[model samples]
Target: MGLRFLVVEGNTRGARQAHKQAYGLTLSESYAEVLQEIEGGAVCDIAFPADEGANLPDAAGLESYDGIVLTGSHLNIYDRTPDIVRQIDLMRAVYASRTPSFGSCWGLQVAAVAADGDVRQNPLGREVGFARKLTPTEAGRAHPLLEGRPAAYDAPAIHLDMVTALPGDCTVLAGNAVSPVQAAEIRQDGGVFWGVQYHPEFSLGELAAILERRTDILVREGFCRTPEDALAYTADLAALHRDPTRFDLAWRHGIDAEVLEPQRRTREIRNFVEHRVKTEKSARGRA
Candidate 1:
């Protein structure tokens, strides 16, 4: 059987913009890569609540998955909308269950807020495009997932708000000058939980589309004066994408190392199981 995973996507925006506006990786390519890895011989299912307005899958229904993953979104967790509230509860349930959960971008904020942390817009504003360095703390240096990683790592980032304070039990995993909390993990015995502020899921093409789609917002926010400037910025990213090795050198954790393939693969398996768990029981009832 395939691994079961419960993927909690924030809303339709997360689904629609994940590739073009967020990670910069094509949805089909990213989803296919993940499905191929997690499915292996078993089934893998990626679930979303449709929109912020849609109801979440029941907690009982989510309990069967091996792990869970949270996707980034345009919505803010601080909002009182029913959909945002539902997502917060979903994240809370995942944490309370001690389920292995991974979060990216907005996913990181969701995890932080659900765990009693704080998030706010950085004084530096939007950090769209790229980061050439992510300096891990001493604690991060000792971490299993981060050990052997470099003192500085480069990754693509896009966000206005940054996680400012972490919960009591969480350990920071990565950071940079603009955002102090780049990634983190909860302290638990034999449990898995991690969150990254950047989008490791994005490829260059996907990132450019996001910049293009949000051109007006960027201009209004003073991120760029004109479309041409935005295009130039995105173009630089495309060059790095074409030759990842140049930028890979700066990312501390050896995200490009062959050794980490095992860890990445393990994450894929866990995610697969978690996604499947959320849907397995429903499928069985029909059987």
Candidate 2:
């Protein structure tokens, strides 16, 4: 049988539309494309509503998919807004199903909260653009979730909140000075949760688009000198992402070639699809 997966969108219509216009794919579409490259299977898209008290997905209803991939969110998890609280409830359902799961940024934060962990606005502020040099913890070196990852690697990131405390049975798999819980693994009675504080699913083009949208914020946050410079910064980064041979241009723009390689940045998701998700499918088939 073919593999099947679900992408739980964390962005609303406004944010998802902007993402589509910039990256030529919606958040769910982008994730589906990435997974398709690895698993070449079906992807199911589901999302939370923008209304005041949207409830979470029913975990029992999620039995169809082999695994779930949680997307990043514009909503901060710490606020406990009705929608966010609902997302946490859905996360609990995900864990209870024992469904192998993977998430990023807000994904990590929500899963942390449901598992009795904590999340907070990083006093250091948003770690946008890049999660630079995330070194794997001792556990990360051996976890299948982190298989094939380098000792230290870079991933595109854009977040204001982070996991400050781990869940009841979770372990820190990867981290850096910017965020102490960059990646984690939670083992519960029924399911397993793996997450990253950065966007391994994001392409550099996506990062560039995000920066383009946030030029004013970046300037105000002291991340860029001027709006024009920020635009140019994204342009150059997007170009180099398309062609690593533009070493000189990349250098002028302050991009490290080693960190700019797409394969290295997307290693985590690749492992999830290839090792965990596929393995689960095979196991169930045999059973």
Q: Which has the greatest lDDT?
A: 2
Residue-by-residue lDDT tens digits, candidate 2, 1-287: 66778788887778888888988988878888877776665666566644445554565667668889898888887787777777887888888887788998888888889899999889999898888888999998998878878778777898888887777799999999898899998876578888899998887787888888899988999889898888888898788778878979766855564357666667888788777787887897899
Q: Which residue runs of candidate 1 sit more than 4 Å off their true CA positions? A: 13-32, 35-42, 50-55, 187-192, 235-287
Q: Per-residue lDDT tens digits of candidate 1, residues 1-287?
A: 55555666555655565554555443433543564455565444565653544555565765566557776677766664777766767777777666567777888888887777877878888887655477878887776545445777655567888888787689887788888888788643333467778765555555666676777777888878997877776665455456656544325323343222333323323432444343444466587
* Clash count in backbone of candidate 1: 24
lDDT accuracy of residue 259 in candidate 1: 20
Question: Candidate 1 lDDT (Cα, whole model)?
Answer: 0.63
Worst 10 residues of 1 by lDDT: 257-266
Q: Could you give me the TM-score of model 1 versus the true structure? A: 0.74
lDDT of 1 at 207: 62
Instruction: Please report, in order, the local distance difference test score of every candidate based on alpha carbons.
Output: 0.63, 0.81
Question: RMSD to native for every prediction?
Answer: 6.4, 2.1
Work out candidate 1's RMSD over C-alphas: 6.4
